[model samples]
Target: MMTISSSTFLMAVVACLLSPAVQALGVLPHTATRTPSSSSSSLFMVGRASADADFAKAPLTQDDQAVDPNVYNVNDLELAAQLWQVSLSSKTNQPNRPANTPFLDTKPFLPKDPTTKYVVDNVVVQVSRTGGLGMQLWELAGGRDDGCGITLIEGVSGNAEAAGVLPGDSLARIQYTTSMQGTQSSTTATEMDVAQAITTLNCECRDFDATMEVLTSLPPPEVVDTLTLTLKRLRTWPQIDVVVE
Candidate 1:
């Protein structure tokens, strides 16, 4: 695989990645408890995966947590990977947001084999309005005209590292709750799909300017408060599922 490191353009694809093993592994809804973040700008639920159920729910406000990871084979990875990836968003009207079918447009970006699976991990992190995400991203292209791409995290720090976000993990979705002005302060989740961000920018001109605009449209480091991230890592097992949430 060809991986290039850059903080320049960070984007990825969102796909309705489903397979047999993935279907069998069903979704286990996780209940998260919200706590005050470092900046106190907002409260969010943060945790890390461990053998113990309680340990997996430790808040990021804490320095650390008990660790006893469960050993797993390739098949087991296929099973637990469903722990993160869930579904796609159908809401629209967000500027430059792709349609629900963009999930299909991203299919070519996957491996030629239909059965390849990935380990999808849901990690919650806090984004500072000033300090930024404090991480470097590796932009990966799938050699498609659809503008579909991938983002791999590196140089981790800030809440990302605290949440156990590892390098080489593919970023899928960034979800944050924000209050709307006219909506009576009603809160709604604002999500940024790394994959769809780049794809939506592909129109008449696929030139450098359009590419830079894609970068600009991304969820900048200035986005504050707590964010839940959907991350994907390649799995070695065959006949498994590929998840993108």
Candidate 2:
């Protein structure tokens, strides 16, 4: 130490001063033989790797992000309702409605062919006096003094109604019998005889049971015993099948 050079003496003095300063700061000296553990180095590497993985897994586009349905506010729903009401008001105010409007379909539906043919066959209806056949008869008039035939007034409901008789039906034929004073007689009537047939029905055939035999003897003073009618509907305008139920 007595023979040290100037440069060497200065270096030793600096090292002595830095050693106490390092001890005061609690810092490890450079001459200490310490190495970081493998576990600590691996933990630091794993943290960096996890951060990179999370960034890679993020959605690339706005469309790819998941949207929550409940995120819409009340204001958004009110706007939608207002827009619908405006559309409905516009449709209502228009003079000519759009084809898509629902009101046009409410009209009565009729078949495409109005003049289709239909036949009602062998409709036998029993007539009694008490339960008068629920119908109003109108004598058809055109170009002739005597009535052409009797037509049914539409919308009358009765026993004939159940037999599918409609308004404007022509009475074609009728057959009945009358019993008076131990005598029985049968008579068939056509359109020409409708007036006489009606007279007989009102006067002689009043209030008889539907199931009673025409030829059977009734109590005194009753002229006509029983009655049955045949109705016919020709296919023309207002095409519909007159069905008996």
Candidate 3:
């Protein structure tokens, strides 16, 4: 729930966000397209979910038609967020850059109850070359570390930019998970039981769905609040080699 009204560190995070590659959402370049015949053979395709489809639906399938290339996938959009690196530093303390905050290292940074979903009200992602990307989370906007998807801001450089990721994008989810280490025990109330219960307590460290949106360039700011963080593997943007039509 930290506000970055005038903090230099806050400004640094904002500096890393992506620039406006497109003046408006509609002005981006024509997305690479594929015809029905070409769709099957095409290496990749970008499209929108059907009205009947759920917002939390899995990545688009072949059935979903190409809505537009200018429109990015959730995965691609989240890459922008990945470019940002968010950490905590007291206002009293100042550094050239904001320190990484291990907010979720212990305790339930996020609630364990399934009903209590994490939702961010307002999220701003900044990308940069000099520093890195910054994810500005606002509590007033309903953002928190325990929410679904990657709570920490991300940055993009080198490989990400070369792959066609643009600035001003926001990631929705990632596609990987690792077992948060827990204690081991045995007996009626053994250490293992305590460790297992604590370890299994589902605190979303990152989200794959949100990351997917960023990668694909289709993140909806309207729905940013309902997203959850998952421990998903990073999706590698499809490598493009010239193709002979």
Q: Pick the candidate with the highest lDDT.
A: 1
Candidate 3, residue 91: Cα displacement in angstroms equals 42
Q: Model 2 compared with the native: what TM-score? A: 0.29
TM-score of each: 0.35, 0.29, 0.18
Rank order by TM-score, top first? 1, 2, 3
Which candidate number would show the highest TM-score if scored against the true structure?
1
Error of 2 at 2 (Å): 99
Per-residue CA lDDT of candidate 2, range 1-245, in tens?
12221111000000000011212212211222222111000011112234558666543333333322112111121121121110122355545445333221101222553333222222334544333344443322222332221222233344444444444333444455642232233453321222233422211111112111211222222444344555433221222244455
Cα lDDT of model 3 by residue, 1-245, tens digit: 33222111110012222222222222122122211100001223445766787775556546453222222122332332333333355553434224443222211112433332121212222323222212222111123444443333233343233223333233333222122335555554544532111111232233433332343352333322112222212222222345455
RMSD of each: 18.3, 51.3, 21.6
Residue-level lDDT for 64 in candidate 2: 31
The alpha-carbon lDDT assigned to residue 178 of candidate 2 equals 48
Worst 10 residues of 3 by lDDT: 6-15
Q: Give one digit per residue, the lDDT tens place, for model 1 in 90-153.
A: 8764465554533211221134554443333233343333333434444333335654544344
Model 2, position 183: C-alpha lDDT score: 26
Residue pairs in candidate 2 whose N, alpha carbon or C atoms collide under 3 angstroms = 129-207, 130-207
Look at candidate 1 and tell me the lDDT of residue 55.
Answer: 40
